[model samples]
Target chain A: MQVTLMQGILIGIFAIIAGIDFWWEGFYIFRPMIVCTITGLILGNLTLGIVAAGLTELAFAGLTPVGGTQPPNPIMAGIMTVVLAYTTGKSPATAIGLALPFSILMQYIILFYYSAFSVLTKKLDTYAAKGETKKFTQLALLPTWIVGLSYGIIAFLCVYGAQAPMKDLVNSMPVWLSHGFEIAGSILPAVGFGLLLKSMLKAKYVPYLLIGFTAACFIKFGNLMPVAIIGVALALIEYNRSKKDVENEKKMKAVMENVNNDGDDEDGI
Target chain B: MESKNTETTPKRGKLTKHDVKMLGVRSLFNQSAMNYERMQADGWTLAMMPALKKIYKNDEKGLADSLKANLQFINTNNYTAPLLMGLEASLEENGEKRSTIDGLRIALFGPLAGIGDAITWFTILPIVAGITASFAKQGSVLGPLIFFLVYVAMFFARIPIAQLGYTTGTKAISKIRENSAIVSHAASVLGCTVIGGLIATYVQITVKTKIPVSAGHTIALQTQFFDRIFPNILPLGYTFLLYWLLKKKNVSPVILILATFIFAILFSWLGVL
Candidate 1:
């Protein structure tokens, strides 16, 4: 489990990416597939990665970023869950079950940093006003990248530092407690999925949702096939609806023009 | 907002638009950037209103006033400070009236959300955590570095995006009257493609479950079809139940925590993986 130079660099890069997402977009960038794939690629455990990612994804599928509100920090959860799974050689489900509480803790840090960064915004704005592109870029990119990279580096150090002790502590967790986590993990994602599904509700979109649900419950196309299908359906529906509306408008405009001509004839008479 | 004794009917306890923008200054010291993180719509307006008014209406102060009107937008209101500013400069360059700010915001929101989701969520966040996770998986000692990387990225990246948004918003609006189709289409394509890629690459889940069949009873009872095929009757049922609870409840999501913990305990005790 010794951190290699290459591995360390990779971790730093991912950390930066995560930080950038928070700074720029403001949503949970982590996902189960992503966590699994990265962990798998890094640890030479593709199956483990997929499993871990799947577990994490399911456990937290419903989490979404709304306006000013924060959900649990999925990036933290997904990353940590994968790492825990890989290091411990535990199943994805088990890893996810164990990681939820830990992940929840990181959300506060994210909130704190976001609130704290207002100070930096004013400084950057003043710099930008003076046409200091270099300073502006420096201000904009450096802090976030630092945040992202530092998270990875620090986590790496801590994990490296605590490996043996944590392993013993986890191994010693009671059977019932461990099993409880598994069950809780299993049920958690439903809430997330529920939230997502609830948020996307609209009359026109309901048909696609039903289709997705049916496919999920019965057909089994796998992964997000149902969701993708919904996306496509919505797109098509919007397109078709707009197209028809345009055609109808043209017809109405022609009718209006005819009526206007009749009025001109009456005025001339 | 201060209360009144019917001299103003207390004015619904709402602050005037000026109060909102002034509050933005307080929020500046108190908070930064629009909080688009809630998956809500407030951030877009908050982050862009001030800048948008300046760009389209030739009124920088007006932009500030508009924001005060829309202060309820929370996290998004702060970032609008930068966006509207850049947009004002961009519009002034084109010699256009600044009245078109509202159109610009409506125009930009969808494309921004689409692009924003991918740019922030897909590309940047993953890159950071991917690096960190790689090490964490191997029991590397740099787990905390991964966390810090995210913090850094969050802090640094906002300025330019907000700035760029302003510049683009003002410019993009004018295009609506001149080759609007091409502009919106391009934005749509970029937005959709990024979203598609992210959803495909992320969101990983695998499911296995079965229905129970009622065939036989006590002595030499035989279980038929569903149970014979698989033994996951409970997991699927539990998933559905959880979904049901979520759909039915108006209760605070905190209740979900209680339910999750309770189920986890129950399942663990019952030996349900």
Candidate 2:
């Protein structure tokens, strides 16, 4: 359970990479499953690592950044969840509950990072106004390394510094609070589904939504792929039907215009 | 309007392949120094610097003006940003009407954002992550591996899309706009169904309650009634309730999260949910 200096550094590097991957390229290397697996690989506890990853992933699943606002920092949560599980020998679910506070803390850290870099953006504006291409480029990319390195340092600290204290703090917690966390862990996924529904739901897609819900709830399919396939079929059918309707409408409009033009020609004649 | 300067002006072939490729790659950091006031303005202008420099090679003032114009408050989908960048760059290189470039950028950004968010955030990531999580739940290494490889492909795929826009110039905009709506809508439908399936599969809340019918006999409500009627009714209902609360109340997500925790604990204590 003791993380060496080299492992800490490696985790730090991964943190930087994940940071860039997040808001930069839109890749999800920072997702809990990947982060935890990497942590497990480094820590030589794949079983516990995967377990912690799964728990944290689900708990954080509902929380995604919409626009500039972040939902709780899942990347930070994932790292701490694995670290806590590896160090304290806690169950995956327990570690997730324990890591929730860290996740929220990291959210503020990110906001601060955003605020701190505002000055850099101002500097970029000046450089850009002056057409100092080199300076502008340097300042433009500054936030990447700054944000990435900050996250890296935090990960290193979590692995190297917070181990014993985290274990103590988690171990000292009263039973009811921890049980509450266990329950909270189970209940939290609804938030993600809710957020997703809030964002993705449209009146036009109501039938599809009902179909999806019914297919899953009534038929009780064990896997998601089949339901997804059905969804694809339904969506394609609707999409094609709509496209044809649009085309037909266009054609009708064209014909009406032609008929009006003919009537005008007769009047002219 | 500026036709007299065309004979003396440099032609449209100023930007080399390298510049476009670099712009495509650099567009990844469009949010690097992003702020609330002018989101992606700094990073975007920075990414376009090289391209603008190429287009306005001898004209420092033109480059500065272009850079300044791009620093205006603009936000759009990250994936298709490169395409806009490419379109703008090509338009600049071709000495197209300035107003035309500005108009196209403003017009395309909002719609691109809608399409990009639907495809990337709502549909692809959720479905892929859900499937991978299911695999990871069983402690398979393939879970993480699949997520990484697939996502990495999607990430790198942005480069070509940008290159396509640059090579094709403004002609591609209408095509992109036309197709994106359909793509976005189709993906959303698929996304909803998959998310629905995910809700059923992942949001597990089992009722472990029993009711006594007589002194010697007790009936398990979950097993005797709920499961028989609908297997994952609790989870579905809970998800629906959360969705309704979010939609109707416009509750702060943080407050809703706290409420969820409190309710979970209280319900568990009461042995009801």
Candidate 3:
């Protein structure tokens, strides 16, 4: 189960790519679903990679970067989830719980980068003023390189350098504590859903939420497709109704304008 | 004086299709140098650089001034930033008043961010991720493939959207605002429903505690009591509690995550989970 040095290096390089994509929001391969699967591929455990992808993806679902504030680093969470599970021979669910500290650590590092990158703004301004387009472009890309390199180093160290200690630490944990991580893993998705609902939930949408929840919990489907279809239907209906409402409002405004014009004409007469 | 020059100059520099396309490509790095002081200001300038250079090829002072104006604390969704870039390119090409261009940029970025966040981040990505994660849970490679393809599609969509913004000029603003309101609303409805199903399917909590019902038999707490009342009441109730704490108490997500770990471990040790 030990990760080979070559595999570790490959993962580090992948982390670099994912890290830049995460910061750039370019390809979005930084998402857990993609990150974990690729990590799993390199580690020769594709099944575990896909399974962990599902767990880690849901666990980090609602943790999006809004404005300047970020949630815990998804790239780290995704990488470490597979790494811990692969190295320690634990369930991916248990590995998710164990990966929390690494995710949070990366989050702080990113926050620091946000502040540290401010120093470059003055130089950027200078370049822009002088119309040094080439220099300006190079300077603008500097932060992304730093971000990618840091991810490469950290992933290499964590996956390759710390494998033995990580395995020993997991082996030494008491039965209950290890079991606790499994339970915690199962429960952690709630925080992600809660964070999502905080932003997206409204009183009007409660009924739909309840419907979806009840359907999933009660009706044993092979998959979630039925619930997704229902959601799509509901969204379509909502879209049509809102379109009509917009049309009606426009009509009402037109009538009001006509009424005002009539009154002005009568006053003129 | 500037207005007089612009009115008299009928042969102002124009943007080519190639230039517009490049702007869209550059927008992928719109947050590359994101910093605390000016946020995406530097990236914004970078994305618009080629277009600005072309538009002000004959005037060095005008190019310098435009670059300075563009680098003034801009932050918006990366996908939709192309629209703004195109719009600014058109304005600069027409030699629109600097004040007019600045005012429009400031006015639109906030609303664009709102619409972009609602559609891309909250609605589309979450719904797709939810469905794909379900497939992925069963070890299906289709899950990651689908999600990645959808994201790439969105990325490429920036090109046509930018072109639309450029051709439509200022006329598209009100229409975009109107359509986004409806689109975001519908998307939210879909997003909420998907999230609800996700909560039930993803969040797992089962009561392991049991009570003695007879000398030789014991009633299972989870299957007999909790499941009888509601199949997933614990997960749903726990999700609600976390939501209340998050929305009402305004606790940080990091704190909430840590608290969940503590509660899970402590409760497991006590044999209650």
Candidate 4:
């Protein structure tokens, strides 16, 4: 479970890429699930990495950056969980308890990154005023490099330097607490689904949701791909039906307009 | 909104197809330098730099002024920002009035974000992430692989939307406005369905408690009732309760997370679940 020198460097590189990708394109590679998988792959335990990531991902899934507020940083949580899980040889769910503190710490680090970098905006303003487009562009991209490097450094330190402390933290947890975490780990995804449903649930689309839940609960699809295919098929049917309904309404309006125009012409005659 | 002359052909401007294509690529950085005060203003201005330079090649004052205008507290959803930037660039290229371009930019931000966030953040990401997460949980590599591939595809999809915004100008905006409802509806249906399935698949809440019916024959609520009658009812019910707390009661998600932790501990300790 020990991270090799090469593994630590590779993890650092991945962390750097995740940091830049977080803001640039937002492909969500920075998410705990994805990052942890990459870390696990480097550490030669892909299954452990994926399981650790899956647990942490659900915890953070409910925590999207809505408006100005920041979510608990999943990147740190995910990476640290994998590191702890590997070091201690504990269940991935137990690592969730150990990783919670780091997630909170990372949230503050992100706040610091934003507040500290806000000062650079003034310099950008000057460049804009001076019509220095090249400098303006370079300065604009500065935050990405800065954040990426910081993340890289943080990953290296965590995997290479803080291994003993993290291992101690993971090994010292009481049985009841670990059981609680296992329970929490299983149920936390509900919050994410709830948050998603909060935003997406329309009265008309409720039926489609029922269909999906029913299909999954009753049928043994084995994998998510088939359920997704079914969902897509249902969506296409719903979409085409709505499209046709709208078209019908439009036709009815046109016919009504024609009748009204004829009545006007008859009055003129 | 006075309609500007559509006769200003894109070919007359200095922006080549390659430059426009590059602008689309640069649009990926729309929030890289984001801050609270100006939000994405820096990124927006940066993304449009190549196009703005060509449009005001002779007028240094024009370039400075355009840059300043763009850096004025412009925040919008990242997915839709590129289209706005492309449209703004095209307007500047066609000699559109400053007030008109600025007004349009300001006006479009709220609506575009409202629609864009709803689709991209609320619906699409959750559905995709939920599906991928389930696969990942099963120790399948396809989960991360599919997520990475689909994400790249959607990320590149913005490039074409930006290109469309630039080439067609205001017409593209109107078209998007008109068709957005259908597009949003279709996506929402798909999103909702996947999320529903995800609730059944991922949100695990199993009761292990059993009631004493007779000596040496205790009836387990999980196996005898919940499992046989309604397998995912507890998970579905729990999901709905949280959804209510979030949507109706406006509970802070952090509080909800804390509640989840406490509930899990208390319930497991009490042998309820």
Which prediction has the highest lDDT against the true structure? 3
| Per-candidate alpha-carbon RMSD to the true structure | 11.5, 2.5, 1.9, 3.5
CA deviation > 4 Å runs, candidate 1: A1-17, A25-32, A44-46, A66-68, A124-134, A220-238, A249-269, B1-92, B97-258, B270-273
Clashes of each: 90, 1, 0, 0
C-alpha TM-scores of all predictions: 0.58, 0.93, 0.96, 0.90
Clashing pairs in 2: A62-A192
Query: Which ranges in model 4 have alpha carbons more than 4 Å from their true place?
Result: A4-6, A66-69, A248-269, B1-12
What C-alpha lDDT values do all the predictions have? 0.47, 0.79, 0.89, 0.80
Q: State the TM-score, rounded to 2 decimals, of chain A in model 1.
A: 0.76
Ranking by lDDT: 3, 4, 2, 1
In the range A134-177, model 2's lDDT, one tens digit per residue, is 88877777778778888888888877888888878878976666
Candidate numbers, best TM-score first, in rank order? 3, 2, 4, 1
Error of 1 at A1 (Å): 7.9
What DockQ does each candidate score versus the true complex, computed on alpha carbons?
Answer: 0.11, 0.61, 0.78, 0.61
Best by DockQ: 3
Which candidate comes out best when scored by TM-score? Answer: 3
The DockQ value obtained for model 4 is 0.61
Q: Give the per-residue lDDT of model 1 (tens digit) for A186-226.
A: 56655654454444333444444344334334433323334
User: What is the TM-score of candidate 3?
Assistant: 0.96
